[model samples]
Target: MSEHKDLNKLSAAGLLISLGIVYGDIGTSPLYTLRAIFNTVSEGGQTINPMMVLGALSCIIWTLTLQTTIKYVVITLRADNKGEGGIFSLYSLVRKKAKWLVIPAVIGGCAMLADGIITPSITVTTAIEGLQVKFTHMRVIPIVLLIITLLFVIQQFGTSLVGKLFGPIMLLWFATLGILGMAYVVQDLSILKALNPYYAAHLIITNPMALVILGGVFLCTTGAEALYSDLGHCGRNNIRVSWVFVKATLILNYLGQGVWLLQHPHYDLRLNPFFQIVPEPYLLFMVALSTIAAIIASQAMISGSFTLISEAVRLNLWPKVRINYPSNERGQIYVPSINWLLCAGCLLIVLIFKRSVNMEGAYGLAINMTFLATTILVAAYMISKKVPRYAIIIFVAVYGAIEFTFLVGNMTKFFHGGFVTVMIGAVLFSVMWGWYVARRIKSRFVKYVEVEDYFEIISELSEDESVAKYSSQLVYMTNANFKTEIESKIIYSILQKEPKRADIYWLVHVDVVDEPFTQDYKVTFLIPGKLVRIDFKLGFRVEQRVNLLYRKVIEELVKNGEVDIISKYTSLHKHKIAGDFRFILLEKHLSKFSKLSVYERSVMWWYYFVLKKLSLSEEKSFGLDSSYVEIEKVPLIFVSAEDIILNRLPA
Candidate 1:
């Protein structure tokens, strides 16, 4: 808790760390944003339109102010889940407010993840493409692929070593951006007029391909969602403070690019303005620096992806996958499956879109969907906070109109490789939706009975010398939320399946709460020492390491004389030895002949065949020791046998 507080506290180091993690995506936007916009407005053999240039620069400036600055940093940052921010974190806070909100939450999360794949591809490709200015025959694809491969490969070992360099390096990178842009901006004070709203409005009204140009303009703020997603890593205050500097540099750079366009109206449109602004002597140094900065940006996105999936799993919106803490750094995790999958996706994207110019459309389209999803969720969050009705309407109206225009503009790129990311988002959303609904469908058939009903029988069986002793202590995981309730299948396993006796029976229930790092538990001794129930209230970010947590609970219980762990055997009790603990993990398999609707069947098919197959087993996921665990296969009967008709004569 102190560590979390430290993260939120305002300090110079905190601000620098925020710059390293939160601003990478947006900070590096000058690489392709202006280039993409210029390419869009000045296609073919025409000199760049002066009004279009001003309008694009104006659009870029205001977009950052409204979308990135006010909407995310000011308003949405306050909608954090215990210092955590992201689509899943936001949903966790407001999910109970509206059941249907999950649709948009999942949509937003999937879109952000899709953005992760393309971000690495586009950033590295654009940075490496700078080399082409000096060596026109250089191949950028292989170099980009090699850099990405090494980046993903290092995820397993962790980045703590090199992560320290990120802050100072990005500091230099942004400083360089400001210096380079400021140098050119001073030459033409007239370019400052592009920051005006009139130029932006004029361009929209005059340009026939306004949507297409807006698509290019939207690229300037593509990293806004990423900034929000990383709110937990660097606290809201740190991000807000860092953004002041980051945004100023970004605006200066764009304005500088605009100034260059005006001065060299007849220069080759193929060459990047960002590169053109730098002195000839410093181009190679700038290229090297940009490449390193691009890697930092990619690293941040990859880390964000891991955090997103981890939260989704805990929230039960995604399948359980293996998560490893490769370093002691706060919130640093490496997901092997996610790592490889992202690598493959990035490599494929690089191969398909060899030039950064070609990837602009896909990148804009993907993140635009994410922004729209985020807008819906932020509005929901505001409503939950009881913000004024008028305020909510105005908020919705303003961003809704702005983001909807961006969406329509991005749609113009659907054929130009935008479908790739859209398709990826669709697939990801299907997986999340399927996993969530499958759990709901399975829950419909689950039977819960009062634990009080079995108290007498369980106590009797514990002392029944005729029955063989199962173990000194036996534990079964239950899905019941109430202390008095236990799964009917668990009761059957205890008394009906085999009259197994034990000194004590334990039922553990894990409840994932909305807060990010909450860890609390309640112990209820239903039948003295014979029957016990432990309810764990863990936050969405906490791992359910039941075995270790249970041990800690028992230590506290024994300290307070709540329970005993001494062996029941006369020979071992005298030695002060602990009793044997055995866990029973009930694995549910869908019944072959169970009845279900087409939609239910399809959801189950996706859950079981695809998600479940890829996920870890319950014991491993819950951090249980396999040596002390036993698996019990249970058939999930959606439609019971009583529902079927049979002829009496046939029997």
Candidate 2:
């Protein structure tokens, strides 16, 4: 195991960039949380009581402190996967001993993705809703949809362009929050008394409506998962250090709102309380700034969704897709399909809810479920790593009580609007889980062929006059083991139809492992000319660059005197270089069988159909140039037991 490195090596500017990118979603919570809470009360048209306002503000502050600052910033961020963090990162850390926990991990990931969709819709719509304060009749839903549409459109270009500006923009946002908050704080200093935890505890235990209020208050900390998920982008030290300033600003703003509500208890703060704190003359200008800040928050989540999907693909928890890492920087990625899916979801949410306050009912549950899942996974991780069982049990008992309470409080709002987010998460989780299971089953059924089986045939082909004259090696890139049908096609084509002999046949298998770097490469040789199997065990953190690894293997072979180092080109490929290397690609097609159930055959057909359309052919999948590829397709009939024994064997 490699020693963990300190995060101080990254410069201050880099640290700030990391914080800006990672913390944007959470940092922008002040824009709508207070306003949403106020709207919930104001809908009744009754005067807001000073005590209720103060109690709610106190709950918001303590929640951020205990949940976001203490739990996530102090403890959760420490469970990093070589500096990466998320449900998947926690899964990797603990999956060895507690593999059963993967179900909940998948659930958490789906919930996070669902939150990704609704968050941007609510955050941006709320900011735009504030615009109605400046212009009484401005349409909110259309503008919100437009903004979300633009957000998705720009995702394909990647975030590196806009990410550079995130730090400065977020810094201004925090400063704006602090200044506006302090301005209100000066108006009524008495509200500062509500900062005590006793006020929150008193309200929860005494106030009859406190349970529902707790559900609303939980909104303020919805961005905590965003903080944990983005830890890898910004190191743990940078995020932890930055949280001090961010958390301070959040607390002051909530307290300032409390102060304002205490004095203006009967004043109807309709749209957004954060915007209300600024002076009348500056209110319009502040609304404009807040709208821009909200858009940036949405943009941050759009990028986050892309990163999560990319990680899912690498882990094989999701289907294979085109994953492009836009920047050389680790964790910077772009996924076109997911970007569009989120855009569609966000637009639909805005059109349906039409107002941020209505959307608030749907928000807290998804994030709460995410928090609960993380706590469960992290506890399992601590136990797996040899932490004392007693310590783990006690930690779980305390955190479990707190999280379960919040989950139930949030669950009370299920029919109130939580069903939308839950449904979205359920659909996504089903698709991902279904694909994961199908892949595993398909892998088990497919047979792998040994390299030794082809050696004798290849040796015989080498004796042919037509094959001996060709100066190229036949390299096949396949995921199938020795028994895969594609292997037989390569044999038939080379020995029967074309009969081209080559100096070497390289059968390569690339297994994507869940680590930063693979410990060793396993090489198996089946006597001189018959077969050779080389398994490249790559770490999860490592990029799959075929050419680099291929060169290293060749060098090792030469150093071991298996081939002449000076005559490598001729020895491996008969004589010529460059165009002389011919990569033979045998694609397998699974024919339909009546014996299998309709659903199973349909799924198999769909897999093959989708693979043919989206996945690269064997040549491209292997990273070979088009000019070097000689492709061949083979159809394999998979006869089900029912067809062979029951139907075909007549009585």
How much lDDT does each candidate structure score?
0.89, 0.72
Per-residue CA lDDT of model 2 for 362-449, tens digit only, reads 8888878788889899888787678799978877887788778788878867887899999999888866776665566465445545
Candidate 1 residue-wise lDDT, 360-427, digit = tens: 87887878877888888989999989999999999999999999999999998899889999999999
Which portions of model 1 miss their true places by more than 4 Å? 1-5, 44-47, 592-594, 647-651
Candidate 2 overall lDDT versus native: 0.72
Steric clash count of candidate 2: 10
> Which consecutive 10 residues in model 1 have the weakest lDDT in total?
40-49
Error of 2 at 518 (Å): 6.7
Error of 2 at 488 (Å): 8.3
